[model samples]
Target: MASSIPLRPLASQSELQAFYIGKDINDVPKPAVILDVAIIRRHCAAMLEATRELGVGFRAHVKTHKTPQIAHLQVGDIPNTPANFVISTVLEGETLLPLFQELFRAGRPVNVLYGIPLVPSQVPRLAHLAKQIAAGSISVMIDHPDQIDHLRGFRDIAGFAAGVFLKVDSGYHRAGLPPDGLNKGGLVEKIITMEKEGVIELIGVYSHNSLSYAGSTLEEGMQFLREEILGCREAIRQHTHLLSARQAKGKELVISVGATPQVVSIKGLLQGGALSPSRHELKALLHQEDSDDIGRITVELHAGVYPILDMQQLSTNTHTGPAEDEIAISVVAEVCSVYNNAERSTPEALIAAGSLALGREPCPSYPGWGVVSEWRRPKGPGRLIVQRISQEHAILGWEKGKGGEEGIPLRVGQSVRIFPNHACVTGALYGWYLVVDSSREGEGEGERVVDVWTRPTGW
Candidate 1:
């Protein structure tokens, strides 16, 4: 059971510093995986900013960074304002509830939405938590009629009308009923009636995507959401008398739509879907798509000794910047040897980090140290790019440098930080990253580890 606790600011900088850098376990040369907190914050912040343009109330998925510290970073010190955290489990909600409950007790409350839809098994725990927690503090999703019936019993048992978000198949089709799927009788009307009768409060409507497909090319997804929200609103109004009463009484219902890819790509397109709109929007939508696939084989048809592959797939964003210089490298191994003899004539080689370090997939070859920036080698031995990856190694090859050993020596046990084609994938691999500033500060050391921060690893 949850009871209101006095609000207190979480630990202090000195304490947090002590906890992380503190002597906790035996030293094991914690082969550090450096993270640029500032840069990461920039990427995450960009995503949040995009939501403003999307014109929806910001409820970031905490799954990206499961740590409370990182979660607070996402919140950016919004005092007296409850952080709107989106999650996938009740345990996740339970872990975060105390933090939010403290805010509520202090008169600065927040809300949490369990991203998963209601399943029969979840009802008992859901009821227990909601009953013990503050009113209107928790919400969950519901898609099928059977789930609603289960929720009704749970609500009755708990003696509290649980908030429900009618799941709609906006586009991604991962969950939620397809927009037309609601036509099999009166599921929509049933949900609307529950809201009116107070058995299940119609808190909001929700949607999701599979995240595997392109998710409707962002533009398509946005258009579909806009139309779905409008259509559902009309459908509810036309069929349900309860919602009509609530509308007449100035009640508002949330229309929550989330999909990192869709949200980031077309957030601004979702304006006017909110029960109420906020003044002054900030940032555009940004999605962290399939960035994990950094170095894998792509079947490029051709004829040669070996068909090499590009390395950009895993290293850079679609809009990656250009490279600084052009240098030539050779493929020590057979040209196509790196890609399981898929084809020939394409160039390939080996590089520093592999699939495990970044994500596993080949990226496009542009001239440069890595795929992070769009450095393409146009002249002579085109740019050397990473192709395939393993947990600790990467396959590299020159796009233009034609021979097995073109110009330079490529060997193992080489320590190199190839500029990643995409920064996000590379950023997530290690626990933390070292910040190095080579510029000297009036006789100070040329480089110093200025900042140290950890990234979220799991739930």
Candidate 2:
């Protein structure tokens, strides 16, 4: 089972004084989303290093943070090299275009992939935007063969080639075609015919192994990875002839796979060199022959939530939950009500953070909406759990003896920080993040509001 840091009161008098010298934690309004910048950078650095070591390209899914500053950190400060990014909404793509344009003007290529399948209505605007920014810099996903027609029409009308990827279903059963027999009915053949006609450019195949998140152990996650690779291999095999034909015309194929669970599992394997055994097998399966005959296969890993972990991420590995320093986001809420449940032999407290603020997503294998940690020291395991949540109330509970001999005496005005079950959704509930440096937290300095970064919300 995963646990939270021990409960501690808000900053002490002296600590509060020190924090007040700048900007204290209590100074911020209640039900605020707090982000630790240091932790996010560390996580991004680790992911970037691991991917670089494995000789694979990384395309960070920006939907998790939806903030350009954090997205920039994920892509790194490298010059000239293109920063690959994936987004879930059209608005996000539009919002990031200016930033991508700036990078392009500075000589660094930046590519954006709208991960969601395109709707006919959205094509004109998307196509126009792609043209204005950088030709072929924006890509979209196409799961169904019919979507190719709409894309082709839009491309002809817009007078530019649009890059696209075939979405392969890797047991998630959510928006993608099955890898095996994908060429049935000459569907892939038609797509290739269109690519030959300059209607659309088939960039690669993409998959999201969401089932990997349900894995209770790292071994289970690895098994999911195997399934994903096998599925992608089948898809590649189905498109081998068509892809080879395109390659002859100077086109490359990308094999992109990820979700946080799969990406993190692969990262761990790469770090331990456990993936070395299967590297040759994967390379053999993914390789294709071209005219000049140098097969171009770029293994692109995409993930979003790994940068800012949550309770669900912590519970993924049962052995030693996520390190205290790894969790970068938390909800700071104040106790609104406290009740003594003599009959149940436990005390309950209501917090200001509720479903609206913290989201209703549940943590697997854990019975709580959020894990409670000390407001001042959020790095340890917590004793109280958020048992229930209403529109504006989170009911926190703990067993009588578990809390203390006298039971946890929570005050009405007391404030505590909660690690949400799902950071992505919880973060969406807030407009901006109250940024803080984790290192300053232990120095008797409360969360000083160093900076505030606005988050993009809505569809």
Candidate 3:
């Protein structure tokens, strides 16, 4: 994908939206991608106000920037957070069916889950992505016991029955089944004999600290989201006597937990959602979450680069505070050449976004693969990072003692933003997303271009 790999947009979405929407992200072309949209609505409304202050329930994964206007700002237009999506491709849940059919015509009822696992050629494309929301809104994700006979052979060829979750691997073995092997792992009694033969429809118990990006602080990411909510409430307390009690409660059971550095370390709590008395066991499971039954269990969280944060989520310092105030995606690139490192004279510059547009991911905090974004300059004692990449080249330098023997000040067509090191692999090599908006109002307000989302490419 080279010859000047412009991943997409060979113009024509009504001429690139009549030529670069509101125009600016360096007036387009140069490894573009941009995004921002007011820090993607302040990091998806601060992760839905920290899961409504720990009452919890919020899925929103969309494989990072699969894009439907950031999956409608990670499901918000809240009517008490209705959309629960999770999709890791069935064409990103059928390209988010027109934003879940316009949140099922505003009365809001969207649900999709199919995050992955239970693969019988993805059951007729999740029975055609559950023919549009509602018969238990298409969930999936199993951990074995032959995916409960692949959902009882997809309820014997789509007569309906695809709503499950199970998946427990609390320690991130990658997939699931391990909250102490959920009651002797017969895959939870073959998913409790197909949810007592109604075929399928369990929907609860998912886990995923994905090792909280090897967290560095914020109480080791709130103790890995308090051990992913005590490993999904210890696999939903080992099936409260083989299920069936309105099939579980706590807003009807869904104890999910996932990564984004342990769900953004619950915004380092304190200030009402409290928590730090040496964290009394994650403050009695996230600030007395209503005192028990894991608070009626609906603790979901799932994440996806929490609205475009990167640099390995600011090197997982857990409370990702400042990377130009929470990254929110960037690439823009240009300054194609200005070298000087002959045996370490240290002073470089290259940019044209490498690793095919800023991504070969690797941010053990510093020593780069992208950073240089001083959020539109004027705040630099010494920055400029990237420090070397290849597939389409990068370089940029200066960090060893924050270099400055007075030399590399980049020039050739200067334009730079960068901030990468994995905003979901620098947004899967961009296929359109120039949008911007640092909450506008003056001096380079995040370089104009207020809209052009697109992205919904190959699985």
TM-scores of the candidates in the order shown: 0.60, 0.86, 0.36
Question: Native-vs-model 2 lDDT?
Answer: 0.73
In model 3, state the lDDT of residue 415. Answer: 87
User: Residues 1-459, candidate 2, lDDT per residue (tens digit)?
Assistant: 001223223344345334333565566678888888888888888888877766677898999888887888888877877788898876666656667787778888767888887777777767766776777777888876667788876686567778888888988998888987666567678778887888877788888888877877766655666677668767876667766766665667787887787677654454433455554344333333332332456667788988888888777772244435667888889988777655455667778878999999987867878877755533222467788899988888762235444545667788888888899899888767777777664663536766677665765
lDDT computed for candidate 1: 0.46
lDDT of 1 by residue, 1-459 (tens): 322323233444454445544221112123233332444455456555554444345565654334454455555455565556666656556556655665566665556666777767767666776665666666678777767777677677678777777776755557776655653356767877777677777765665542312333444444444444444444343434434555555555555554443344343444455422211121211121111211111110000000001133212121132322211111111122242132445545454455555555333334443442221222334445554556655566554444443332333332333454333444446554444222425432322344444443322
Top candidate when judged by TM-score against the true structure = 2
Question: Which whole-number lDDT from 0 to 100 does residue 207 have in model 2?
Answer: 89
lDDT, model 3, position 181: 74
In model 3, how large is the Cα lDDT of residue 385? 83
- Cα error, candidate 3, residue 65 (Å): 5.1
Over 131-184, each residue of candidate 3 has an lDDT whose tens digit, in order, gives 655566688888777657767666665677888888788887888778767654
* Global Cα RMSD, each model: 12.5, 7.7, 17.6
